[model samples]
Each structure stands twice: as structure tokens, then as C-alpha cells.
Target: MADRLRSIAFAIFFYGLSVPIVLGTPVAALLGTSFMRGYCIAWARLGVWSARHILGIRMRVEGQRAAGPALYPAKHQAMLETMAIAAMLDAPAIVMKRELARIPLWGWAARRYGVIVVDRAANARALRQMMREAQAALGEGRSVLIFPEGTRVAPGETPPVRSGFAGLYRALALPVVPIALDSGQVWPRRGPKRPGTVTFRFGAPIAPGLARADIEARVHAGINALEP
Candidate 1:
């Protein structure tokens, strides 16, 4: 109960503090998109700091952060990994649902930051658009991060990855860096966050041109290392 309260308080505090920064995202965009992107990354770090001091939730990354741009398909267990990964990576273009890119302030900031928004209902067209956006990001030397599962699942659950992940792999022809984490054990999809260290284990980059089945199987094994 105490930890829950602390977690809630930290969220409120962080949101309150970020309101001004989020509001000014457009202004920063006018100067350069990197301004807002850097701010957002810094904001993610702040959230991590609050999680540690206020909620007693720590982070333990098991592998070295990817140095250059690559296609990153990560486990989707909780929001904690989202924040932590964004903070740890360099010039990341996070692929997300279109709905999130519609929220007023955040949406504006995301656009300026070059976040790749996908319309899941649009099928192949969406994949094509995402491929274009992802290629553009990679061309700019930025890492592209996608949650292959499309949505969050419980820590022990493993859902079939959306086909869009394969689309990116096929289109970009870039090595896929699969990352696994147990963030859901600490920060769940719905519920109070528990206090613990979230571990993100990054697997070796898989060369491009593998069959879809093989890529999916390898990614599944890599991301589910934490599953019992």
C-alpha cells in the first residue's frame, strides 16, 4: 500500500512537472525537432529517477545499449520498459499506435520527435507507410524501436507478434535486435507498480533475410527468456 501510494504520487508529480515542458514542445519544434526529442528523452530519465527514489523500483540493463541504428523489436510487458528504453537509446523513433499520436500535447510532441505512428486497421497500407517512416528514420541514423506484440501483455504471457514487425524486417533489410525484459513484473498493464529491478536483456542482432517463421521464432525465444 505504501509503495502504491508512493508510485501514484511520483506519477502525479512527474506529470505536473512535465505539463509545462509538454506544452512548450511546439515552440521547441519551431527551433528543431531534436529539441523536443531530447526533452522527451530527458523526461523519460526523470521518470526513471522518480521510480527509483519514490517507488523504490530500480532498473538493471543486462546488455550493452545498441550503439548505432538498427531495427529493435522488444517485449511488450509494461510501460516501464517503454520509458526506460527510450531513455537508454540514441535518437530512437518509437513505433506506436495512431491513437496515441492523436492526444493533444503528447501527440504534437511525438510528431516533432519523429515517432512512427501506425494505423493497425489500415492493414498493408499501414505497413507500407511504417516501412517508409522507419527507413527514413534509419537513413537519418536513428534507431527504430517497435513493440512487435502490438500491445502490452502480462509478464508470463506471449502473444503472436503482429505481422508489421516482419514487414519492417523485410523492407528495411536491417539486422533485427531483439530485446527481452521482465518489466511487467514490476510495472503492469493495469495495477499498482511493484518495487523491483526491471532487467532488459538484448540479444545479438539477427542478420536480415531470414524467413518470417524463423525471425518470429527467434524473437519469441529472445523476448520470453524471463517467462517461466
Candidate 2:
């Protein structure tokens, strides 16, 4: 009961505050990407803060943070990591689905903030576009964050990464920093949130240029390293 109530309170507070930010995103965009980056980061931090205080969920991040431009293929178990990534990373260009990138005002802000939107059902052209944007982000010294599974999964489920991961890896030619987290244990894909520590374990960087099979295997193992 308490957890459910807290979850409700957290959602209300978080989304309520987001109203004004979403409305002002256009102005932020006009201020330029630099200002918008800061704006997005601030919003992400607010989410982390609310999760900690209202939902009683704490974050425990392990391993060293990656340096320079690299690829981050992370475990996707809950929405918490979506916000957490922005809060933790240094202005990374996160890869998200086309649906999310189409969410009206939020989508507008995300595109302006440099998120790389991927069409899951797209063909070679979409792949090329994704790589181009990812390369541009890397050129700007920003790491590219992607959830290889493409969508959220339940705890303990280690789904094979989508094919696009390998294509992007090959195209970008950057080291891969796999991230494993147990956010689903606390903040699930459905139902009320629970109160527990969400652990994000960052694996060591896998060097670029590995064969498609090898890279896929390594990332699959790395991102599921924390699963029981």
C-alpha cells in the first residue's frame, strides 16, 4: 500500500513539473543545443531525485564511467534507466524507438536534444541515417547509448540484441561499454513501483572491430551479467 501510494505521488510530482518544461522546450531549442542539453539533464536529475525521495528507490552504480566517445549497450528492464542514463552520462546521444521520438512536445525536445531515433521496422536507409546521426554525435565527443534489446524486458530475461546493434557497432567503430542493471526489481515495466536499490553495473569496454558474431555474443553476455 505504501509503495503504491509513493509511486502515485512520485508520478504526480514528476509529471506535474514536466508540464512547464515540455511547454518551454521550443524556447530551449531556440536557445541552441547547448542550453537544451543542460535543460534535459536538469529534468533527468529531477527524476532521479524524485525516485530516491518519493519512491524510496536508491541507485547504486558500479564500475568506472566510460571516457571519450563510445557505444553503451545496456540492459532494458524498466523506464528508470532511461532517465538514469541521461542523469549519469555526459550528454550522450541515446538511441530510442521511433514511437518515443514521435511523442509530441517531448519528442520535439528529444530530437532537439540530439537523441538518435531508430525505426525498428526500417530498412537499409534507416540504418544509414541512424549511423550518420550516431557518427555525428561521436564526432561531437558524445557517447551513444542504446538498449540492444530494443524494448524493456522483465527481470531475468536476456533477450537477444536486435540486428541493428551490430550494424551500428560496425559503422561507428567505437568501443562498446555494456551496462547491466536490475531496475526491474524495483521499478517494473508495469504495476506499482517498489522500494529497493536499483543497481547499474557497467562492464569493461569491449574493443571495436570484433566480428558480428563475436560482438553480439560479448554484448549479450555483458548486458545480462547481472541477471540471476
Which candidate has the top score in TM-score?
2
Give every collision pair in model 1: none
* Cα RMSD to the true fold for all candidates: 1.3, 0.8
Give each model a TM-score: 0.95, 0.98
Error of 2 at 185 (Å): 0.3
Q: How well does candidate 1 match the true structure in TM-score terms?
A: 0.95
Tens-digit lDDT string for candidate 2 (24-94): 98998899899999999888888999999999999998996677788999999887898898778867999
Model 1 per-residue lDDT tens digits across residues 1-228: 876798789879887888987887778888876777887888788878878887788887786655667888899887677788988786589998999999988897887899898998867777788888988898888888899888989868899888778878888887778889988888877778778888888888888999999998998887787788
Please give the distance, in angstroms, between residue 103's alpha carbon in candidate 1 and its true position after superposition: 1.0
lDDT of candidate 1 at residue 180, scale 0 to 100: 91
Clashing pairs in 2: none
